[model samples]
Target: MRKLLFFVIIFGFSSSIQAQKYSKEVLDSMYSITQQTKLELTKPKSIKLMAVGDIMMGTNFPNDSYLPPEGKGPFDNVNVILTQADILFGNLEGTLTDEGENAKRCSDPSKCYSFRSPESYGKYLEETGFDVMSIANNHIGDFGAIGIKNTSKTLEKHNIAYAGIFAQPSTIFEKNGITYGFCAFAPNKDCIKIHNLTNAKKIVEELKQKADIVIVSFHGGAEGLKHTHVTRKTERFYGEDRGNVYKFAHTMIDAGADVIIGHGPHVSRAFEVYKNKFIAYSLGNFCTYSRFNLDGIKGYAPIAEIEIDLDGNFMKGKLHSAKQIDEVYPFIDEKKRALKEIKKLTQEDFPESKLIFDEDGSFTQQKE
Candidate 1:
């Protein structure tokens, strides 16, 4: 009888310890220690995530001629690179509604752009291997609530997750035994506000508790050709507050975000490493078509591929240089324009950062 009782006691203790292994405090401590040590454990399980900036993929709301050729042919050049990643993300800069009056009123209808792609375009996103998209841009609500609802349904039908909308500000999914969470923010109607740091931190913290890895995407910063650098201060465009992207990224990192992706500047900015977390200030225009100016700096952007360990520690990244040719399709640039520009921007904007980018587009952190 005593032997059986001892065996029961041992089993109970072992189970209790196993249960406590994943408690909040324990996990926090483990992550902190791993980050501090900066240990590159041998053969640790990791996930590769690829992200890009604003993508319109051609719009055919008021006109059908703007749509790309019937099928997945539009993504022929970049689909392979996109599909290779475990998770592919991008910013969907327009609504996917077939019929809705545009809510945005521009002084000059000719210059003020509003994109409304047909619902069928969602299939293109799915075929291109876009797992998640951020609907937190200025153009998402071009057709108001109906536009938002239809866009959500279209993305759902295609089995693509989206964040930054009214109903779904964050999403969680599991891949290869790892749980990943994504949330997006923007200073636009019907989207999570990027300027609200308190709310942003709260949302990110809640997501961090629910998933092993958390990625935050924000659409902030001023726009156009001159707004290419990270000023590290609140930026304004046409007297509108665009939020301080630098402060926002650092705060999100401190709040347990594993990766921070920024866009909306329409130009690529610098990269930074904070607390062993990776942050790309702005990815610029990825695959915009028509209604967008693709001149000089605005045309160059990077297809950022980042790898992180199971614990969400920064590992390495590669920037695939791409450019929007003829203001339409995005093609791989042989000149490595985006990579070289990012390297220069990173050095200029974040001179003290520990992250380093090589000529071949590969990136690593400075060893302690």
Candidate 2:
């Protein structure tokens, strides 16, 4: 009888430990230690994610951001930080294929915007560590469906995957051998060309079934300014109002999305933890060289990294921000010390940000 009681006690203790393992607080604490972030990843462990927002490679493209025979872009400057993650992501704010019907160019340079990039250069995205890109943005239809088709084709040709819009396959996060499904919604209306209402719900539901975790991206909200804070109310664009981003993002979360990454407001917004998930309201511009936006305080882009368990529940996360310095027509900036400085300001912007400033004013990712 004593032997059986001992066995029961052991089993009960093991079950308790495992149950405590997944509590939201404990998982978040463990993720703080994984920011050194590596690929090939650890098993039954958390996965590190890196993301850039609004990759607007326009007429002012930088050499580092674009590959040869593609364009001159500075995307390579952040390659180290970006490539070190398990899978990297970004918002492809411009179409990648040249075959699409060109968007009607806005005449006002101050308000002008239309985006395209050569398809051949997609190899750079693969080489530079971008495993997935989101196509649900205003520019997805800039070249029309032909352009969207060409962009999807080029991404597939390069073996670089995408999600959110076009004829793209649902992307996933593969960590600890678990596949996580990805989907997105854009107010751009073009998302319907690829993901209709029925299909969008279907994909989200399917992701819940097939993925260890599900991440949803959405491009909805008014453009420009730090006033992009999302509420539980509808928003307007070009005089047409749309669903509340807060409601939409959380709705998808309830429907099985483990995380939510939102963009399109050319400015960054405060993030929150909802339903045991992390939601970055916006990350703004990462490698974009647009001479147009004068965000001033809001244009600085965040290099967001999140850690999640095999089932894609939020563990912990951090943001490494970078600023777009010049406002020139052809814009580009070296990211050498900029990363350090940008991180400093981010700590100011987000009091809860992991970065800590020393008494002497230096910043480090970990407080220890």
Candidate 3:
């Protein structure tokens, strides 16, 4: 009975929508309207968004051993769920530079982890259904400015929208009839600073004015298995300030961000629904091959699928549990470890929050 119910929910929610394309005149007219008028005039439609954590699909710059086979094996296990969404997003943990001088200095090579994937890997991301990627993480500058430029160029060549690099701090794109604005922030150098609350809020507000839905991604917070729970305060790691992720997320939501996705902590954290917006504290290491530590909790993550109304209000979501085994490709976890862990963390951290998750991984808000 329980299994049947789960399938029913999945099938019922997996809607196939064909967005009506508007002419340039219609789009311009829509943009010119006031917020209240726009909301009243817009037709409500369900928009599905899939978000995952850090993705460093095997880097071969330092060595060839880390590279995967010459095929689409990296995302084969998870591509089904990925392609189902209208928009798919994830944090690009490292640069996609084939050749460049590494900029990061490490005292101990054994402990340091820097990634640089081949430029050809950008197509693989597109094939795996990644429409937009966040390039604002500590390792994004592993190969310096050259790497950053190459990463942006490569993604653009593959028709993927990217943000949080160079002067392109935010990207606004339209799919179907819904306009989405995406921006990324991190505490690392050469990206939008997550610590600057005033600046962050201002950017989100500006994005809100242009797009119907604004989604913000941040790579901040302490890392490792020990950092599974959100402290709701400022966090620091290795003498570097990781920013107050709680305040940052809430502020972004208040500034008109419909969704907030966080990743940096290599472990999964809690989920919260603030002011009808959904926020995932940390989605953990979605797919970090070779160099990443994948022991215990570090390997657990969820391919989060979220559905929101045209007005950017949270509707429902599901967590498809996945885990990396032996630092290789990610596979669905039979035990649903990621889902269970998030449930526990959400209960402990936001006890009074309206978001409710069932054992089957489907989530909804409590009735008023």
Candidate 4:
């Protein structure tokens, strides 16, 4: 009986030890999971994105006269405003190739303009806080495949992400633990066509699956000051179909795009908030140097600084106005002409919008 009792006690003790071990393991696992959850909750959830339009600092195609001076940087005047954002974006209006044949056939040589910035000029964009560039514009193919290849190589070397051509339709990148997907569209050859909504939707939907936020850039609309307004209908510029920007923006948002930025008009346009997403119809001429026609409204360089949640909901935004004068680089406009133009255009185009604008250049969506 004593032996039996001793055996029973030993068995009970072993069973208790096993139970404790299992419980301890479960508790440890639960604790680890809880800690991981806490970390996730503490991770950064907001991103500041800054965007500008049409950045052709200078081109050496025709001659060296169109290029900026040796010691002076193109963005030196507005570097402070640009360097403040987490992601700085712009449309690269030209190629970054030193030597390539100009493929554009000009009926009138004087009317034809081909831009080919030197390869060294890419560093200036990088230094000026340009994180990504849209190589999906009319001028991207001026120098043919070699220009595209050289531009890609230079951007890669500078760690500046770029997309929009047939070869590189979209790009995925990470910043501050948030994954971002970016794609660009244009009506020009060799670029991802802006008129193809089906393809655009497919690209954006695929990006939404993998990225925390998706940004879509379209180079559409008619060019020059007369075409500054969003007409809501399909626009044709110089016999080319510039997609209906209104339809495109709404469609992209429906297809999981969080932000829509439009350019190619070479002038600022209205701002819109659709389904809680932000859209900038056009950002205007940002840093086009000598060869550009920076006359009056064409010189308005508005820097759009936007804040969005990790899910890419529009939070707030600010428009910093800069203007190009004397056919030189852009300088901060104390008159706030660009902001005023945006405000006026937004009011005229989207009067029913729920966005609240302040005199200080800040704007936000009205809380329902």
Query: Best-fitting candidate, measured by lDDT?
Result: 4
User: Candidate 1 — which residues are off by over 4 angstroms?
Assistant: 1-44, 69-72
Better of 3 and 4 by lDDT: 4
lDDT of 4: 0.91
User: What value of lDDT does candidate 2 attain over all alpha carbons?
Assistant: 0.65
Tens-digit lDDT track for model 2 on 213-263?
A: 777777777777635556556778679655477777667777777878877
Query: lDDT values of the candidates?
Result: 0.87, 0.65, 0.87, 0.91
Q: lDDT at 185 for candidate 3?
A: 97
Candidate 3 per-residue lDDT, tens place, 1-368, comes to 99999998776655321123335556777677766576656644788999999999888756788888776467789887888999899999999998788676777654567898999888779888788899999988898888998999999999898898657899998776678899999998888999999988988999999998899999999998788888989999999999999999999998899999999999999989888889999999988888887888888968888999887888999999998976578888889999999989999998777678888899998988
How well is each residue in 249-333 modelled by candidate 4, as lDDT tens digits?
9999999999999999999999999988999999989989877888889999999999998889999999999999755888899
lDDT of 3 at 216: 97
Compare candidates 2 and 4 on lDDT and give the better one. 4
Which candidate model has the greater lDDT, 1 or 3? 3
- TM-score against native, each model: 0.86, 0.71, 0.87, 0.89
How do the candidates rank by TM-score, highest first? 4, 3, 1, 2
- Clash count, one per candidate: 0, 12, 0, 0
For every candidate, C-alpha RMSD to the true structure in Å:
7.9, 12.4, 15.5, 4.2
Query: lDDT by residue for model 1 over 1-368, one digit each (tens)?
Result: 99999999999999888878758778899899986566444334788999999988777655666676654455677776888988899999999888788787777655557888888878889888888899998999988889999999999999888899779989997765567899999988789999999999999999999998899999999999888899989999988899999999999988989999999999999988888788999999988887788889899968999898887778999999988865458888899999999999998988777678888899988787
**Best model number under TM-score:** 4
Candidate ranking (lDDT, best to worst): 4, 3, 1, 2
